[model samples]
Target: MGFQEFLGNERIVTALRGALRTKRVPHALLFTGARGVGKFTLARMFAQAANCERLPDDFCGECATCQRISQLADPQTLLEQGLAERGESADAATVERVPLILQSHPDVWALVPDPVRLKSPVARPMLRVGQLRAVQRAAYFQPMGRRRVFILDGAETMRWDVANVFLKILEEPPGSATLILTAPSPYALLPTIVSRCLQFHFAPLPQAAVEKILKEKTDRKPTEIKLAAQLAEGSPGLAIEMDVEAAAQRRRSALRILERAAQGHGFAQLFSDTSALAKDRDSSFEHQIGVFYGLLTDLLELTSKVKEPVLRNAPLAKELESLAKSVDSAWVLRAIAGFDELYVGARRNLNRQLGLDALAASLAPAPSRASVTHS
Candidate 1:
């Protein structure tokens, strides 16, 4: 699609178009923002604009070159497509074994995190040195198009050694190539790397903007669309990709825990509820933790008496408001902090039950003065 098709981030679009108009495209670009804002989409469009045969400063989006570049897919999609082509099941074992770099056009490379060590389910996916080395070698060649574009998705996944390899490329970039790196924030990357590239920060889209985009892109129910839009926290990409039913379920489960804790439930009851929630494999534990965090944030907002506070779980606003009254701002703030730690721990494959237990314990309200005095 052309740049006009990309919604939100008008400033970034203008800057990219200006770069094209002046024919002064930087050799490297760093797009920093939260996940699913539009960094990767913009990167793809920029690559097309740089190489589109039909336009000098913009993409027609119909030319052979532009169409080919648009075929780029994320790693999971690429892997699934490959497996489907082979008539093989995309089982966990099979998925863990594949290392992927999706290239739809010879001149366009889309790099994502692959398992650093193959055949190991626990091995974190990263942009390893080997992948950067391949890009390094490819960078020296003349491209079939005007520019060879490399889009490094999730660039923060690179460890120091791998980042060092990429640093060399940035230090001496090829004349005919442009490198694009996308990360959640610039601080997540190396200072040296951040200093080398032209940086752009992508802001989250407004909820209305996100809702409009969701209507355009997805066929989910209007209610689901509205909920997804609210829960996405301004990322249209996230709203588009979110599993609405699963999100709702997660929110319900998270709210149950909050309710129990607010009512000063005992450890056994809290642990039992947490165990049931953790056992549901419908969604990732990390995602479950994220939902809990969102609920906690909403509770914090309600407890703090924010004027017209926008909530991620708007459907439960009344319930959250009622719950907010049962707890003080101090406990909600502390619970939010606990969930932040739990979210990070979830990413590290922490024991879900144990972590949830600890979180529930932390969320336990202090004893009432009457009870303490009676005891």
Candidate 2:
């Protein structure tokens, strides 16, 4: 797919397209963004475009090369071709000298993740050291095509030992090869690895950008698109993954807890509910955080756009107004700080329920003042 097919991210599209046009594709690139934000998808398209014969900013998707790439048949053939050489006695020594992976030719071999160490981890799949080794092994051989591209999705999942494994290769990668890695965030990656590659940061998509693509790509209803776009917070990929029914359930749950946080004095109930909520893998702790962020974004939007007293959440908006009467900007800042810390912990494999419970407790005012009032 051409970058033009990608909605939003005009800056990224422009830069990458320009690079392709100039034939100045970087050997290594780091794309950092949230999962389901189209990072992996984009990286694949880039790999295809680099190998494509049609020279332009956009891909002529009708070409033989384009068709093969679209079908992901090119790399497989390359792998198969390399394998034939190694087994054939025609040139056994040269073939044997080639890396085992290259012995079959360059193909996408996602690194095996380290055995799961954390008890409750958000990352189900990770990239392993074995995968990084292949990058080096593949480097000795020349590309069958004009350019060879290796797409590594979930680069941040590289365990600590394997994390810096790519640094040396990235620093001086083969001219004919390109390594494209995508990750939710680069902060967790070793700085040495990060600094060596050309970095591309993907910002969350706007609501309109997401909706347009949904309309273009799928047969979703208008309302479904609206709600999904609203909930995805700018990630079109995740928006597509979103189940309308599940999203509605999340809203219901969030509203329920939000009301509890607003009016209920039983701190124990809030803690218990959130604690239980965090343990739910089906409804991921991250998804719940998205729900919370969505609510806050809605409230902020409402407060700024509307003339009427905050009407969205009667209880919570009312509490917000009351707090606004006395609370300085610092209180809101502190709440964000608490939530941010929880978000950090959640990413670092902290217990979701504990992180959220602590966040709710921190966001809630001390019990004496925040206690439920009787009419």
Candidate 3:
């Protein structure tokens, strides 16, 4: 629950830690990164570190100030009080604990449209104008805690009005207030808003880090966790996000596919897997799709020995190599084209199961549209 406990982003930890040591931390900091990359966690830690009453090195968790701040016990908590009551630096452990509750925190707000919208016709979430209005109201209030940190979880959902509401605050934010905003990409944010805050870019975590967390957090077999981690594209958030059972099942299914493919697997099993995934009509559908995508990505990574797992076309790798050796790269290229389009179609409105079925059928060893090349 401290900086030491933070799973990834060591450089970020070091920078904030350094700033706290010098007591020259900026008032307006924006933590931008993919979801679940520890931006929010770091923000809360930084908040506590700025005002701990402990020794110079860090916040003493046992201090009266630390106790009050850590538990959010004080209603009248002000930034100066938080800073004054603690050690020269606040306890990172205590602050990190706060973010664990951030999703449900009343004061901590998000304006994103529903994720289920991806399942909707539009496939997009809209951050309404009201969310921005709340930010205005929060800004008008004095510090709720030692600092009133406004963490916009899905900043990309910000509508034009929402982004505009931020312009004023970002330009002249309250002295005691801090904004720890997160988004998948800054390109989605307004350049004006981007210009205002001290932006902290968070890159993806290492695959090893993702694997470690997945293994530790899930009761799934080590093999299953490793598969998910590999396919997760270094996103620990994605790995931790799986419900243990669903994640386990997905891993099992994917491994079965890989095991079969390794052995020049039959087509019926792939068809069955695709059909089964498509049958999940409720919440599990998204998980199934994500798992399927991750599964393909793992196979793709295995094919090229490419360190990054961005390719979800991996299930087709064996065929790719065969075709590449026998024919020109054209056939492999077409296979990729077909799947990429299929992925896009699934992402939009096409039936996911059908897409997977089509993909599976195409990749099948027998009667495939693709003819393998003999080396």
Candidate 4:
């Protein structure tokens, strides 16, 4: 996709376009922002624009070069060309897609870590030294295009050794190569790495942009779209990815728990809901903890008067307002702290029902020692 498809970040787009127009693109760039803010998407677009034969400001989406960069032009021909460039003989079926199959484009290479597994004790995938070494080896080659672009998605996932290797490349990069890195924040990487690259900070999209994307991209109800956009915290990718119905149901269940906890009533429904959530193996317990935290968030937002008029749980605005009136900010703050402790405890595979009960109990005026047990 071209830069036209990217919403928000017009300033960044303009600057990058100017650089391209001047034929002065930097050798290394770091696109830093929150998750799903289109850092990787923009990097792909930049690669397309740098290599495209017929575009100045934007890549013609249908051009042979643009389509190849996008991994959609001609898989078999691209595979053959990539194999020939690398001096390898491989069948087309053996080839993977872009980012994974870095050889798909003669002037493009991608380094992306595997999916992070937060639930398990296993570590998140990282950009290893070997991967960096491969890129280093490929750097000296003459590119088929006038410029070569190496896109590194999740640049923060690199370990110290890997990062050092990447630093060396950035220090003396190939004259024809442009390196692009995407991360949640450059602070996660070595200062040396951050120092070497030109930084572009990508902010979250506005609610209007997110709503527009949700409307254009999905068939979710308008109410659901609005709520998802609010919950997305300005990330349009998150807005579209949200399971609206599931989130609504989760919020309702969390509200019930809050009601029971505040009133010091029996937590029968709380236990029942938590048990069901635990049974849904596809849904993480962390999500349930987040829902629990959302109740306190709603209370604090509504009472503080500083938050936007649109609440995450607007459907339960009356209930939240009623709850807000019953307690002062001190109690809400303590309850929020208690839920935060429970949320941290969730990472340790704590008993889901027990954690919910403790969270519910903590909402009372006098929290028991059990409330802090998981903390």
Candidate 5:
């Protein structure tokens, strides 16, 4: 899609279009935002615009250059097409094992994190030093198009060594090349790296925009689309990819924890529940904590008696309202604070059951101290 068709972040679009028109694009551009907020999409669009032969400030999308760049932008589609060409299986396992980079255009290169050793399905992909070295070698070469565009998707996945290598390339960048790096935030990268580039912060899209995109992209039901849009909180990418049923189940589980805490369940029962939930393979502990936080926010809104409360878990309004009656606003506020602490700790490798148990204890009413009879 052209920049005009792209949803949200109109200001960034205008700035990029102006840059293309002026032929004064930055050598190094950093796009930072939350995941699924259109940073990579905009980066790809900018890359296409930079090299589009027919249009100076925007891509024609039908040109040979734009078509090839589009193919390079969508790594998954390129991977599938390549596998089909080679008569290889395009199954989930095979796709997972393959690295996801596409250089369909001589002037465009899209680099993504790849598994360091490809040992297991759960292994996290990282941007290695070798990958940056290849880009550094290619950046100096004259572009087949107007500009050689190198997109480093998920730049935060780079280890310090890899980032240092990338820093060297940025230090002595080629005039013919433009390097685009995407990350969740500038703070996630090295300060030196942040200082070297023209930074663009992508804010989350509006709920209406997210819903519109969901309608266009997904075959989900209207109810599901609305719920996912609300849960996505302005991220069209997240809304499109969200599993409504899975999210509902997580919210239900979170509500159950609140109910048990309100009923003053014993530590043994709470601990047992926590252990079982920890063992659930359907979702990660981090995701569970997020659901819990969302529920706490809803409860706080309900307890505060907000007019027309906006809730992330809107479908569970009846259940949440009932629970809110059992507890006061102060209780909900304390739970929110406790969950916020647990959420921070979720980043590190902590024992899941212990974390859940701690959250449960925090939610439970404090033990009433009884006066002991004088002996």
Candidate 6:
């Protein structure tokens, strides 16, 4: 993708273009932002622009060098040649194929964690020292072209030893090479690693921008696009993944829970509502809690207004209106507060069921006292 096709982050784009125009591109650059916000895409364009044989400023996308870099063909060609040299058969060659190459430049070396180390599973996968060493070895080599670029996609995943191994190369990068690192945030990386690079902060796209990307990239319906754009918190990637039906279902479930509580049904119905959130060790439990929190926030917003409020869960407008009519803002506020506790507790790794029970208890209306007659 050229800079022309890339959307949003105008300031970052301008700065990068300025670097290219001046022939003062940094040897090491860090692109940090939320996932799916085009950091990796922009990095690829920058690399292609830097090494383009014909035009370095605007990047002639048709050149052999640009095509190879954009396709990440160097490593693939190297692997295929090595296989051919060993006289591997077709069947074996199929098995030996690299799984993760979406694309890269021939002059652009892409580094990621070795899958063997990642097979065991972890919250964060470790980028092994071997990968860094390979990069280090390649660092000293003369480029096959005018400029060489190394792209580390999940730079934050580098283990302590792995990060340490690359520190020297990062500080004083070798011949005609530019290194680019992409991560969710610079804070996720080591201070030493962060300090060595020229950092570009990628901001989340605005709702309209996210919606535009969704419209262009997917066949999602208008309503789904609208709801997802509102719910995505400015991440186009998240917006594309959001399912409108599922979110509406959660909204309905939340309204049902509120209705049961207001009817003085106590913990039974609300407990059932949160049955999916009983796990202390699972992240899904946290997500379920968040869904409930979104519901309460919707209720609070709906009830505060005499009419319907603008809703991400717009499909649940009728149910929201009904709930708003029945419950006062004070009651809805209390329910919202209850969910706040559950959300906080879930994050802190407190007992999920206990938190849900406490939340339900707080929201359940006080028991009615029978009148005592004096004879």
Root-mean-square deviation of every model: 4.6, 7.9, 10.9, 6.9, 5.4, 8.5
Which TM-score value belongs to model 6? 0.63
- Model 5 sits at a Cα RMSD from the real structure of 5.4
- What tens digits encode model 5's per-residue C-alpha lDDT throughout 152-182? 9889778876688899889998998999999
What candidate 3 gets wrong by more than 4 Å, as runs, is 51-127, 140-146, 243-375
Output the number of the lDDT-best candidate.
1
What's the TM-score of each model vs. the native?
0.81, 0.75, 0.57, 0.67, 0.78, 0.63
Q: Cα miss at 289, model 5 (Å)? A: 4.4
- How many clashing pairs in candidate 6? 6
TM-score-based ranking: 1, 5, 2, 4, 6, 3
Q: What is the alpha-carbon lDDT of model 1 when measured against the actual structure?
A: 0.80
Summarize candidate 2's per-residue lDDT along 137-215 as a digit string, tens digits.
7765677666777777667767667666677788678888888877767775788888877899898887789899788
Lowest summed lDDT window (length 10), candidate 6 = 366-375
lDDT of 6 at 251: 52
- The digit string of per-residue lDDT tens for model 6 on 144-250 reads 76667777887877765658888989877785888889887776688999999999898877778988999998898888888877766566866676766665565
For candidate 3, write residues 128-223 as lDDT tens digits: 454555676676576543445565656766665657877877777776666766665566677887777677888777778888777777777886
lDDT of each: 0.80, 0.64, 0.55, 0.72, 0.78, 0.68
lDDT of 4 by residue, 1-375 (tens): 578888999999999999999988899999998666778778878888988888876788778888778872233344344445533332222222211335457888776763222223133345655567778778778889778888887787777665877878888888888999988777667899999899999997888898998999899888888888876767787677778777677777777767766665455655575577667654556556656666777788777876565565667788888888767778778778876676555544477667767666666666433343332
> Model 1 over residues 28-86: C-alpha lDDT tens digits?
99999867888898898898999999887789989999988877634466644543553
Off by over 4 Å in 6: 72-104, 112-126, 247-375
Better of 1 and 5 by TM-score: 1
